[model samples]
Target: MPTSLNDWLRILENRMLYLSSEAAEQVRLSAKEGKCEGLPLRVAALVQEDGSFHYAIGFEDTPKDEDVRFSDKGVDLIVAPASAGNTGRSMYPFEEIDPATLASWLEKGESVRLIDVRSPAEYAQGIIEGGELMPLHLIPLQMPEAKEGEKLVIYCRTGMRSGQACGFLSQQGKDGALNLRGGIVAWAQQGLPISRADKDVSVG
Candidate 1:
């Protein structure tokens, strides 16, 4: 039992990708057969009628605008926004934060540094309280640092690009980098209020 998001982050990062050499070769061959060579493997979790889950993997030529891409051992993995939620941990190349869990973090007054990695126009619509606007394109240029025991939570419109940000941050050895599972849509769905970008600035 990992109690903190940071703990969960470490656990998930190690499990993001698991492919034996032979399996990797087989996947490449299958992609070539399907005329999907050079395309990324789009993975998703499907909920079965029995309330269990089935993991789906395929080579996707067309990906959504908000999709996140990760490279593991030369294989590109494509993931759609909110797609990670089907699996409890999101299994993207980074740690994921559920909207409800985040709300609880805020309620408990935990140290969380929230970042909104979306375009300026997208960020203006409404943002999670205390979110600092650091557009996805600008993440590399202006990444945030977390203090001891502070969680670095990043999100975009659909939790896709922000997931990319988390991957980048983790590569930089930054801990507690969590992506909001479904972005703001999921947040609003949980009855969590979105506030002005200037108000409720808790993490400074």
Candidate 2:
């Protein structure tokens, strides 16, 4: 629930690698037994072209520029931007923003383009405030005319479709399109403001 992009990235850095205290202690002991005792632990996940994921964990003397660096339970952890799509098979250059940051953007009067990648029926049931209905299937066609400098954020019911949409936009050489992590479900769960129309009666 971070209100800014930097805060959101910091949260992601800490949560991306769930190193328990026991695990950290084990790593520390293992490192001490080995010659490279003080080296920092680097954890990375990559999505392959065949819709598969690969993960790596090891000690590194230096961190990459794009790596999100932080500590969890006394264990140093680093995550690269390439690992954003680790939860799925598709990999692209888009980023993920949390609901609180999106809310903060709106509250600060920032010009952000919010696109709802859900179906019309689903959108009618409930939608994030200021989100325009832009079904996932039509993103390729409609996104061509998007403003160059606008920050575009897409979301679906549970973030699956929106992630795909973000990947598609990234592939098209578009910049500044981000997926809303956990989608509108996460948004409402955080008590963020949403808009519901009378056309739908079901809860998504």
Candidate 3:
């Protein structure tokens, strides 16, 4: 019954919140603290074009009729379709590697897999050499092609988004995925080389 996009959003946000039993329990505790009892929780992805996620989460006392329903460990939730994501919590390890270490690897000609989780606009400005541009939204689709035992090092403008990507990867059971500490900002500040993405030749 929505007539416009914003109206549609008033009715829904296409995303999923997958919480493990432990994570669900933690959420339960947090909800208790927020005093959001008896109200269904909603997790909205206030994402930006640069593949950064800004979540707007809280209780929804009156969910729209068309809103998708999901329940985990007695914590009711309202979301949209799957594909929109958040792997609530990870049971695997996550770590960040400083810029110096990553630069050293590239200098030594080590076969390090570099994934750039940045928007094309941002990527066009510059990128780490040989880095694959797999924006946050595309990870679920592109990550499957990753090789076994691949040494993946993900990065962004700052360390934050890469850390999120690493955590998401960890949730997928891909162990040993490393985040570039301080991200490209640190790498550039350290005088490590950055390649300008050729709009014509960049991987589609």
Whole-model lDDT for model 2 versus the true structure? 0.66
Compared with the true structure, all predictions reach lDDT values of 0.66, 0.66, 0.64
Error of 3 at 68 (Å): 35
C-alpha TM-score for every candidate: 0.56, 0.54, 0.54
- Report the Cα lDDT for residue 85, model 3: 45
For residues 1-204, write the lDDT of model 3, one tens digit per residue: 122335446545543345556446645754575577777766444333554333334455555554578787788877632123442331123556788989888888877888888777788889999877877667777663346755789988875456557756766776567878667888999999989886753445
Give the Å shift of residue 106 in candidate 3.
0.6
The TM-score-based order of candidates, best leading, equals: 1, 2, 3
Expressed as tens digits, the lDDT of each residue in 125-152 for candidate 2 is 8788777887766787788335766778
Give the Cα-based TM-score of candidate 1 against the true structure: 0.56
TM-score of 2: 0.54
Off by over 4 Å in 2: 1-90, 144-149, 197-204
Q: Which regions in candidate 3 have their CA more than 4 angstroms from the true location?
A: 1-92, 144-149, 201-204
Model 3 lDDT vs. the true structure?
0.64
